[model samples]
Target chain A: GAGVSQSPSNKVTEKGKDVELRCDPISGHTALYWYRQSLGQGLEFLIYFQGNSAPDKSGLPSDRFSAERTGGSVSTLTIQRTQQEDSAVYLCASSFAGGNSPLHFGNGTRLTVT
Target chain B: LAKTTQPISMDSYEGQEVNITCSHNNIATNDYITWYQQFPSQGPRFIIQGYKTKVTNEVASLFIPADRKSSTLSLPRVSLSDTAVYYCLVGDEPISSGSARQLTFGSGTQLTVLP
Candidate 1:
């Protein structure tokens, strides 16, 4: 719609449960990004999509973390076997393809691993 | 991507002009300086961006010098609602880093506008 949108504004999961967070980027935007922010901390890059392809996946914190984007519009970030340390606000952002294009961010999904 | 350095925190009173500066000593020729502001419980909002000289928008102004090593974000007539964390980011391509390095906005300056 008008801006980047994220699903389940808040999510609480058990330690071993899996969770998926979805993002709908601004229409026609070719770049999407995922970032995590712990309480009182700066943002940590997770992964990004140039269209539906993620050029790199090494930024993921662990093997259990994965992300995918489809239709160059919607993207999902999945966390497996959640840990207490995984609790943080997961943010999604989108911008035009260029590097200098400013990103439009969504209100993040605050994931709490209990 | 160019690494950015900024202060940890700053304080200003209402109606005062506030300038937060960011230093990027190794900024590349293609790098552009961008600024973002975030409040508690919300995502960051773009403030302004610049390559050199000055850029002004309804919300703020970005001033970059000739050398491009440093840039400043100037907020005019601050108010309590302007209290937030401001980040300075310098980068070329968002996804071009591949697996080598990740784009980052370093610990930002926490600006508190006292009423």
Candidate 2:
């Protein structure tokens, strides 16, 4: 792909339902990141993948949230028992390492929990 | 973490030069200043970056002070297309504290370029 790609550009789910978002990073990129943006707010760090494994998940807001990357290229973010507060845009980005490299972002998935 | 402060918004006319300044009073010696531009409903795009002094590219110029506590992103002869939210980010490797090159975004300055 030409850039980072995210699935389900938009998602609306009922409270308590589980939802999953997917991201496919730019080919050969070694770093991937996930962030959340609430209404009129700045991007909040969620989780990131150094390759196929996440070195840090401290940004995950709660135990209801989890993520995984496979084959060092694709990632999935899963949220369980969704609550209204879970509504926000989920953005995925990729970079090349200490990579001082600029991040390439996906259009993002706007998840709306009802 | 190195924190940055920037104007909330700015208005400019097409064809004029636009300068957005950011203040990071406690910036680290290894920190690098970076700028990103985002249009409505889209992901932000990297504009330019600098570690010190001045750095120029085909799109913009980054000017950092000797103290490295502040930096400015200069867009020459702006156009309406330049209207967007401009973010100032300061960091080194591991873009954020979480451990990757995660560029943290501040409450960017909204630049409105009028034609």
DockQ, each predicted model: 0.64, 0.58
lDDT of 2 by residue, A1-114 (tens): 599999989999999999999999999898898989887777787887888778778789999999999999999999999999999999999988774788888989999998
* Stretches > 4 Å off in candidate 2: B95-98
Model 1 Cα shift for residue A22 (angstroms): 0.6
lDDT of 2 at A9: 95
DockQ of 2: 0.58
Question: What tier of docking accuracy does candidate 2 attain?
Answer: medium
Each model's total of backbone clashes: 0, 1
Writing each residue's lDDT as its tens digit, candidate 1 over A8-68 gives 9999999999999999999999989999999999898888888899886667999999999
CAPRI-style docking class of model 1 based on DockQ: medium
Top-scoring candidate (lDDT): 1
RMSD from true fold, candidate 1 = 1.5
Mind giving the per-residue lDDT tens digits that candidate 2 earns over B8-91? 999999999999999999887677888989887777789999999999999999999899999999999999999999999888
